[model samples]
Target: MAGPSRFVVHVPFTAPDRAEARQYARMLARVLGRLPEVDPAEATVSPEDDQSVHSRLFCDRLLSGGHRCALRAEHEAPCAVVESDR
Candidate 1:
């Protein structure tokens, strides 16, 4: 059997301090959880950074819709979609 399809969603934000970064990450996590195509329980949010954020989302099915939603949610985020080759 093959593994599930994977996606990397990059979320970028600029914050003046660590406190703001922490707060923003939590808020964004909620939004990502609410995405119709995402299974929040199966998603993994990586460490937050002062300049960017990223998450690894897994699904049994295709994820183009989910990718599009993430990009649309934050138009300024420098995000890209790449399908797993493995």
Candidate 2:
């Protein structure tokens, strides 16, 4: 069987620091994820200087119904999907 289709989109922007960059990535993912074709859980951030080194912004744990964890990576709480109420 064919594996899942995958593609990469690079969105470059300026950030004061790594921490701020991560914050921006998360925000972007959440916004883009609203689209049916987008998978926010798979979003990752990397510095322009070292594009090879990627840091995940979400927990991305496999969850029920084939969904992935929406919490930030390494989050202390149990993995869960993004609530619509948010």
Candidate 3:
């Protein structure tokens, strides 16, 4: 078995405000979350700083392992891995 699969995908970006950041994040998630590898319900977006927002997308290998790897390979920003439940 592949084991329990989960990842906290961090996508960084700058936005004018929380609303805009959320809009942009949602837009990005709309595309990324829609991918077979992503669980949209578990996806979340939050501001890391005044200039950047972080998008966390959880994934399961059974759903889209290939797609997730492809994204990780192509992503410009370094992704953050959630280490624990808390």
C-alpha root-mean-square deviation, each candidate: 11.9, 2.8, 12.4
Q: CA lDDT of each candidate?
A: 0.48, 0.89, 0.53
Model 3 global lDDT (CA atoms, 0 to 1): 0.53
- Report the lDDT tens digits of candidate 3 across residue range 8-31: 777788899866776676567556
Error of 3 at 54 (Å): 8.9
Question: Candidate 1's residue-wise lDDT over 1-86, tens digit each?
Answer: 99677685756677776456545655665466666555443444445542244443322233456653333232354555533222
lDDT of 1 at 20: 62
Better candidate number, 1 or 2, judged by TM-score: 2
For candidate 2, lDDT tens digit of each residue in 1-86?
Answer: 99689798998999999999999999999998888778788899999989999999999888999877889988999899877433
Best first by TM-score, ranked:
2, 3, 1
* Candidate 3's TM-score: 0.50
Instruction: Please report the candidate that would top lDDT against the real structure.
Output: 2
Worst 10 residues of 2 by lDDT: 77-86
Error of 2 at 5 (Å): 4.2
Q: TM-scores, in order shown? A: 0.39, 0.82, 0.50
